[model samples]
Target: MAEWGSAWSTTPSVGSRVVVTGAAGGLGRELTSVLAGLDVTVAGIDRPGTTGTSGVPLIEADLTDDAAARHAVEEAADLLGGIDALVGGAGIVDTIHRADTFPLAAFRADVEANLLAQFVVAQAAYPALKAAGTSSLVFLSSIAAQDGLPGQASYAAAKAGVLGLTRSLAAEWVSDGIRVNAVAPGLFATPKVLAMPASARDRLLASVPLKRVATLGEVVGSVLYLLSPAAGYTTGQILRLDGGAGLTLGGFYR
Candidate 1:
């Protein structure tokens, strides 16, 4: 594997202050554990009433709202002293619905949950991230943004928006020493995925060259890489975690 000279550390520096949104979700939870194990001071933000992750300070606030997002980041910054990195993993995938009949309300809600929340949190963290002199912001995007996944019109659009925001922020924040990037993951072996009917699951895997869902470790590792010194020069990039699923001309999955 090609490596960058001396800057190839897969783990963030110990004592780095990091904040993760949606830290209670499956992927977020796993990412937090790995970061904490590396001795990085970690704090998390999730929706109100969500279960808190052990050992990590959890701030429950609605990130979609500007005021609430600012408050959450302030609380997290206070807990960590300051922010060196931020992972925008908080999002929602409301019930899948076709584009033709997807409710206007749901479409708006999905965009707010997935796209707006990310931007809101990032904006709130800007001052702290800038003060850190050099920092990283990694957002969770989805392969739905790349491939046509049936019944996911809103999700696909919102995730696509994330890609745009990632690049825009990277360029705009470069002078501030804050790098912005995103991870676009395909099907992953989460509980919700495992519970899918066998036929549907198999059909989904058939399109991928790897023929299997990604492990939480595999996907989380990619996120960690971006947050680490290894990707110090990488910004405005979307790291796709799909198993060559995008290499083919596969049609939308029903």
Candidate 2:
């Protein structure tokens, strides 16, 4: 890992402010910890019942609510005196049913939680990101978005939307010095993946060339690269950290 100062000639200082949504969750917590290790001031937002970790300030907000999203951004900005990066790590996966048998309510809820929440956060943070000039915005997508898994229609659609959002915003904000990008992770050893049935878990692992799930730290590393000056010229792209699962299409189809 390169020192923060040497990573980007124009990158913000280590103590710069970063806001992460879904902070209490598996991936979110790992991201928060990594940012904190870099000496960045982090403000995490999750729903009620999810509290801060490691003494980092955690704000309770259902990001699906536009007003609450805006308020969280405002409060975080005020606390940090400014915002340098906005990492939208909150998303939901409805794995209970196939598309044909999936409940409409469940689908709608997944869309709201995964897709709309990201939109709300990005919209609310646009001003702060623009003000920061060289700020970065990262969205957590999934391999399901591109692979279109059997029972993940809602999650796939929502994460696919995130890819579109990242590209469009990266184009729209280049002039403002804000970079927008996304990470598409394959099966990782997160709380969600750990909860899958044994058979389903084995099948998921078999699809990957590595035959093993990723760690939260590996996923966070890719995110940090995108947000850092190392990827200063990289934006409007989706970094797939799936252990080559996307390349094993024949196995998945078999």
Candidate 3:
């Protein structure tokens, strides 16, 4: 993958500050790697004991806790001096279960983990982003949001909320010169998806027009572009990075 520096030769130059949540997760770690490669000031928010990316300072905090979530962002801004961009990639994928059988507690917890935490982190970073004048935020949404498949009731609801929040904030924060966007991926080859039963996983992959899971580089590159000046004029958009999984004649689902 090309270094971000090789593409954009603009402000937000060397030493630009960035904060990533769930920085220990598969996608988050990939994002951190690219940011570190670009030699920027980076900070991460992850659960305690998570060995986050090398050289990136991490704020150990439970993002599901509102106070902890806010504090994490505050501390990261302090560590980076200021935040020029944010990637809210922290979330959990609930175990597959029928909607009728899904526990109320688990459903609520999914909402907090996947939706509320993202909002709290973004709110916490608002001041630093506003101060930066020109900034960007990328929220990790999911194909489940658009796919009302069995066993995805709770997860889909939360991810859909993320997309809605992304649009709302994009319109509201544009005045502050913050470009907000979302990437809703389908069938990514992450640990969580890979952990799915082979039969289930194969079924999902076969539904994709491309018949494959999205690569980490593709998703990471999209995030980088949205957070870069290249997408300066782009905001309030949802880039469905689904490997053509959601592009079928009548329906994309199997």
Task: Give all candidates' CA lDDT scores.
Answer: 0.90, 0.84, 0.86
Pairs that clash in candidate 2: none
The TM-score values for the models, in the order shown, are: 0.96, 0.91, 0.92
Best by lDDT: 1
lDDT of 1 by residue, 141-187 (tens): 99999775688888899999999999999999999999999999998
Q: For candidate 3, what is the lDDT? A: 0.86
lDDT for each residue of candidate 3 in 1-254, tens digit (9 for 90 to 100) = 46665456433356679999999989999989889889578888998889898888878999999998999999999888899999999998855779889988999999999999999999999999999988889999987787765686888899999999999999999999999999988767688777899898787677687877888988898888787766777899999987776667534455
Residue 13 CA displacement from its true place in model 2, Å: 4.0
RMSD of each: 2.2, 2.8, 3.3
lDDT of 2 at 125: 88
By summed lDDT, the worst window of 10 consecutive residues in model 3 runs over: 4-13
Q: How many residue pairs clash in model 3?
A: 0
Question: Higher-lDDT candidate among 1 and 2?
Answer: 1
The worst-scoring run of ten residues by lDDT in candidate 1 lies at 245-254
